[model samples]
Target: MLNLDVVWTSEFAANKWIMPLPADAIPTDKMIPATVNAATYRDTLVGAPYYTDGALFYFRSDLLKAAGIAARPKTWDEMKTACKAILALPAAAGMSCYAGQFDKNEALTVNFSEAVASAGGTVVDAEGKPTVNTPEAKKGLNLLVDGFKQGFFPSDAITYLEEQGRRAFQDGKLVFLRNWPFLHASLSATDGSSKVAGKFGITSIPGTDGPGVSTLGGRNLAISPFTANKATALEFIKFFTSEEQAKKRLALSSRAPAYASLYADPAVVAKRPFFPTLLTSLNNAQPRPKVVQYGATTKAIQEEAYAAITGKKDTDTALNDMQAKLTELSAK
Candidate 1:
């Protein structure tokens, strides 16, 4: 048995290193559809969906209330308007508008994919074809590029990874931050380490029109092809992914559960106040490109996306180059 990253499903399946899962025996019916999709490769179910995660929009709620903003922004335009109001306040004097991971690393690929998806575009289509050359894709990439050019994102954000962004938000240096669900516990801590302990709020990341899509992330449980005790492995997998176990895990460790019902459970919500918003983001999440060559695919995205975000290349030129690179990668 192996605990595999969701992005590795296609790679492992293509290499014949993992056996296809017996869908009838697994409790996939109760799992999040996006997680089930992540465990699938070329129409074959290859892994059992495990705990899952998605990006969330983290903001300084107190700042929004002070600005008289009645609700969280659901669209990019609304976010910009809110930023204008919040930044003008004396309390928000040193804060920047927003920030996401933009360094030339794997984080960049995740951020880039979410941007395209939120604008109603895809980095790669369902059939494994590159689709980053469309008008929607351009609009998506422009959100980051234009954000930097307009000073919405801090100038130093080009060097930020997850930790940097989290630190900035926890320190009350940002009005909004795009990050994963795990940050909820840390940011909500009452320790003196968090400057905005009770002042922050979470929602679905804003989109061009409405709520944005997040990049799906999590691990999957798979049976190794060489394992002799296949029956035993399957039994363990069933036990591990069962609803009872999932609920226990969530309660014990705050790990996001794959079971959809847990997100709505009163007890679960009482323990994790962010579950409802997280469920909304997870339902709209898109898996990062599921290809056999995921490593090279993500590298290509990071390079082009970094260039565009840092003003080294215009959005069109960067995405055009990315399209060609992805086209070649898919063909391989």
Candidate 2:
């Protein structure tokens, strides 16, 4: 039997040395939903969640206070004000996600998906119909695209990956950042790697007065169907994913756990300053479409966001095209 389910998770760093554990470590919650288009590995009661991640707002407290802002922005309009405030202050860049650069690209997809849903738009209809061109989707795309074009964020941001953004913000090149939980450790560590240590704050992703939404952006644990020692796997999972471990992940590693029980632990929450904000966003997150076509549709939506912003296409017309593409893609 494998001694432990996950000796090292992809969360800390890419699990290259420990990439493929003998078993799986995924979640079984119906709400978590599967990502692949047609089928998913069984929603097995896989290994315990070491840590999960979601959308988080990264900002520099020094810069914000200097600009006379005392609190995080709560709504989309306020987000605009905050972005503009930071941009107007020389050397403080603001950014959300890369526009339509790559698909399955966690940062871009989650950022765009969350913003769309936060604006009260559903990616798929009740009948599993595609709805990427709905009014809410249009507004969501415009929100980021406008920021991109007008330079609310760094001009080079669209070409950046999550780590690239992390480096930029840590280097003081950016004042506002929207990224995953990993930034927590990278920025706060006493280690000299980050230039902006102990100076940043986190908040829930801003909303638009409609409803706050952020996409699910982390991995869950699952046992492999081929495992010969399921019980051992489960045992290892429990040990590695206990409350104590979870807290360590929050403090030392910056990973979130999916278990509701662990969330109530004071130590766990305390270590992760953004725990409350993440929970709020998690509570409101809309699961991605379950159809086999979901991934392809997401790519289409990315194109729509870019077209509406950089392609010089009419916003309404772009949306219309998106709606059509979604309809065709999601069709049986």
Candidate 3:
């Protein structure tokens, strides 16, 4: 058996490196729908959905409360309004509005995907073709480009990876952050390492109209196509993704569970208060572009998205460039 990132499902299946799993043998009905989709390739289950991840919108609850904002923002405009109020406070003098993984790497691809998805546009069509020249797509990419242009995102955010953005939020230097679930544990720590400990809250990422869709992230387990012990591999995969083992993994490492019931479990909820919100995000999540040539596809995204957000190219020109390049990649 092989452990694989969700994005690798299509690649492995297309290359015949992994065998398609028997649908009747895996309890996919009990797993998060998005995760199950991630393990599928061309409508066939090629892997067992394992632990999963989705991004959360983290903000300073204390600042919002102090600014007299009682409700969390559910749209981009609402978030911007709330940021305006929060930043006007004497305590928030130097804080920027938001940050995400914006560097020119795989992280950039994920961010761009989320931005496009949140705006009700898709980076690639259901048939795995590029579709990024639409109005919705332009609106999505402009959120990042305009953020930099309007000073909503800090100047240095172009250099930020996940850890850098996490540190900024934990240090109370940001009013909001777009990041993954693993940040909850570190930000909740009572130690002095976290300046915003006990002062922050998490929710679904905001969108142009309402809640946003996150890029699905996690690992899947697949049987090697050449494996001799197919039955044993199937049995082990069942055990590994069982509800019992999932709970243990949750308690031990704080890995998000693939099963939906665990998100509502009292014990689990008590330990991780963000599970309910995270479950919503997961349900609404969309996997990053599922393509056989994922590496090249992501590189194309990062290059154009980086150029636009950094002002090296206008949003229109950059997306036009991205669309042509992605078209070439999809053709191959």
Measured by TM-score, the strongest candidate is 3
Cα distance off (Å), candidate 1, residue 162: 1.2
Cα error of candidate 2 at position 301, Å = 2.6
- List model 1 lDDT by residue over 1-332, tens digit each: 99998889998999999999886978888989999999999888899987999999999999999999999999888999999999999999888999999999989998999889989999999878999999999999999999999999999999999999999999889999999888988898897889999998999999999999999999999999898999999999999989999988875786798999999999999988899999988898889999889999999999999999988999999999999999999998
Q: In what order do the candidates fall by lDDT, top score first?
A: 3, 1, 2
| Ten contiguous residues minimizing lDDT sum, candidate 1 | 248-257
CA deviation > 4 Å runs, candidate 1:
none
TM-score of every candidate relative to the true structure = 0.98, 0.73, 0.99
Q: Which ten residues in a row have the lowest lDDT in candidate 2?
A: 32-41
Better of 2 and 3 by TM-score: 3
TM-score of 2: 0.73
Residue 273 displacement in candidate 3 (angstroms): 0.5
Residue 50 alpha-carbon offset, candidate 3, angstroms: 1.2
Candidate 3 deviates by what RMSD? Answer: 0.8
lDDT by residue (1-332, candidate 3, tens digit) is: 99999988898999999999887988999999999999999999999988999999999999999999999999888989999999999999999999999999888998999999999999999889999998999999999998889888999999999999999999999999999999998998897899999899999999999999899999999999798999999999999989899999886897898999999999999989999999999999999999989989999999999999988999899999999999998998
Pairs with steric clashes in candidate 1: none
